[model samples]
Target: MEIKEHYSLKEHHTFKIPVQARYFAEARTADEILELSRHPAFRSQEKLVLGSGSNVFFTKNFEGLVIKIAIPGIEITKRQDGYAIIRAGAGVNWQELVDWSLQQNFAGLENLSMIPGTVGASPIQNIGAYGIELKDVCEGLEAMDLESGEIREFTAEECRFGYRNSIFKNELRGRYAILAVSLKVSDLSAPGVTYRPTASYGDLKTKLEAMDPKTLSPRLVSETVSEIRRTKLPNSTLLGNAGSFFKNPVLAEERAKQLIKEHPQVPWFKDSQGIKISAGWLIEQCGWKGKRVGNTGCYEKQALVIVNYGAATAKEILAFAYNVQSSVRETFGIELAPEVNII
Candidate 1:
């Protein structure tokens, strides 16, 4: 592994934020990662594990080593009860895995069609979109302990997934490097179209009825998901963004009921703790959509997406996000937490 000094991170991250890493190394295999952990330069310094760098905001130059995970491979193995297990290397692009599953007629990841980032980062947030989450299909993951360089496998339960949270982002934060993830997917067809975009566009029951159980096509689901996401989210090539900036805040039932009394049209979904309020709706209610500050602004199409119009600095983008958060909180008495990890 060739470690470079003063690496530009502008192009590495999807936000296109101009920032520098003091030291950088690309690890293509598990052994390479272990070796890097032993390096004196990395041993005593704060280390950042980088995947595709899609879900992060770099406010300033990093003072430590940024280890980019570059390991790549995918294997499909047989599992019990007509299911198949998919093991993907951490460096594998997330969308490519979705496409591969479609090509192979595997049926679990269709709803996550256009999400950016790498396989290694998916479980860190237990990423979800449409109607499915990574945890819904996750079987296990192989991760190396950053301190000892010893590899350990964690089951789904061990991950402790919640909305935009996992053990990797909390208890085990910065302590483990995810090397590969194993997911169990069905060979036999099953369709999940309960989410808004899917339900509005596809006739789920009708499509399922038409497909022969013995020879169902995964592409049917994948294509439907792709079409919906393409229409919903801005193309990253055209506009730099890391999808939604904030998580939809879940309010206590009593708080939601109080809000309902104030604003009868407020939309919500029941969760284990209470009701999850839509962040987009909250922002739009606060009148921040299409609001621009310098070159950074909220997307005209998606209230939740903060965009870099041309040359917005990381600081400017974050300032804009803070303004949105402040406005939403003042209006609704709800605090919006960022989904994008601000580094």
Candidate 2:
């Protein structure tokens, strides 16, 4: 619990934006977090509970304490008839967890491979890709109340998981520090049992078409998804980006019908809300793809991603994103909301 004053956050965030935190500290255990919370500086200051800092942006210097969650470990806590409950520490790398599960013959979490950030941030963001979501495997979670220092547990239903949303990101935002997550992963080696694999989303169908379905496993699916993601998204460490800067907007059925009539080429998929339009497609239609504005620009391969060319400030990125947003709105009459959490 060594708290430092005026810590540089350039290396902490995926965007690599240069910003300073008034105070910064790392906690590897629940007791350490409680101790830091009791400190005079933390008691009176605003605090940000951070993981690997992959899903956040710094619009300016953080004015108060930034507590980086570093708690660690992964262990099987319970076993059912055909599946097991695994508890992972908040600090565990998300992709590492997926790889470990595959090695252990777990059938879930393969489609979520290569996602950036720590386990602690997964539930909050409801992180998803290739037709699979965290909520599908999550059993429960443990978190510490920031003010009371009391640890609490929540079931998946209690978390209110939504598309890229959860109670942790809304009602309980800034209120709790996640300690661990409990996931129910299938035991693929279980006798007379086989868990269905997710391989129909995006290009996965084409990728898996030549493979034997009987031989399909979590490891294979994980590898396939990893390759797909690598081809589409740039490495954040090298290019300085948080993937998919904007959320795909969902519109009512009537609104979607209107747009489809206006632009016959528009792509969409059916959802509970209505129709989910492709944010990337919309941005590309606005002529922002492969486009650069000073130090900030849209990724050439993926229009939804905003990249920092070199030493780009937070303001520059924000302005560039706003311009894209305005263009999309003006052209399509749909407002795009940012997926990146701007600090």
Candidate 3:
């Protein structure tokens, strides 16, 4: 629970934004978090629980206590029938967890491989990729109530998972810090067993067919997803940016049909809520792909991603995003919402 003052947050976030936190500390356990919450320095101030900082954008210096959650460990606690329940400390790197699961012959999470951030943060945004989401594999989670200093457990239903949304990001936002997460993974003989006879998603299916059978295992799906992502999305470590800047706006079926009538080539898919349109396609259609504005720009390979070319400020990034949103609104009549957490 060592706390520092005027800590630089430039290296904490994926965007590499040059900002400062009035106070900063890393909590390695739930006890440490409780101790920090009671400290005089944090008791009367606002607090931010941060993970890998992969999904956040700081628009200005935070005038609060920034608690970086670094709790650690991974354990297989129970096995039943054909599934194993694994528990991981909130600080576990998400990508590392996926890789480790594969090495142990665990399936289900292969589709979510290559995604960024920490295990604790996965449920907050209901992080997903390919055709799978965190909620699909989550069994339960443990968290500490910041105000009460008491730990609580939440079942998957309690999380109220939605499309890139959850109670942690809405009803319970800023109220608790995720301490650990329990996931159910298949103890299968191979990685892609559940996804056979063919991959579920179209792009993945195409890639699998193109690969040699010897390489077409559960690990292959993860490897292929990683390869596709590497070619499409910029690595935040090499280029400063958060992946997928905007949510694919979902509209009522009728509205989606109306838009499709105007632009017959528009791509969309049906979801429980409504029809989800392709945000990247909209941005690209507006002609911002590979376009640069000062130090920031939209990634040419994937227009849904906004990048920092050199030292772009939060304001610059916001302005560039605003222009894209306005263009999409005027052209498609749908408001684009940010996927990244703006602070």
- Which candidate, 2 or 3, has the higher TM-score? 2
Leading candidate by TM-score: 2
What TM-score would each prediction reach against the true structure?
Answer: 0.91, 0.98, 0.96
Deviating ranges (above 4 Å) for candidate 1: 189-217
Model 3 lDDT tens row, 155-182: 9999999999999989899999999999
Report the lDDT tens digits of candidate 2 across residue range 298-324.
999999999998789999999999999
Could you give candidate 1's per-residue lDDT for residues 1-343 as a string of tens digits? 7998999988788888778999999999999999989988678988999998889888899999999999999998665555789999999999999988877767788877779999999999999876578988999999999999999999999999888899999989989999999998876543432211233223343454565654445666667667667766788778888889999998888889999889888767676667888888899999988888889998887799999987999888978898999998888889999999989
Which residue pairs collide in model 2, if any? none
- Provide backbone clash counts, one per model: 0, 0, 1
Once model 1 is optimally superposed onto the true structure by TM-score, how far is the C-alpha of residue 210 displaced, in angstroms?
A: 14
Quantify all predictions' global Cα lDDT against the true fold.
0.85, 0.91, 0.90
Candidate 1 residue-wise lDDT at 167: 98
After superposition, which runs of candidate 3 have C-alpha atoms over 4 Å from their true positions?
Answer: 189-198, 211-215
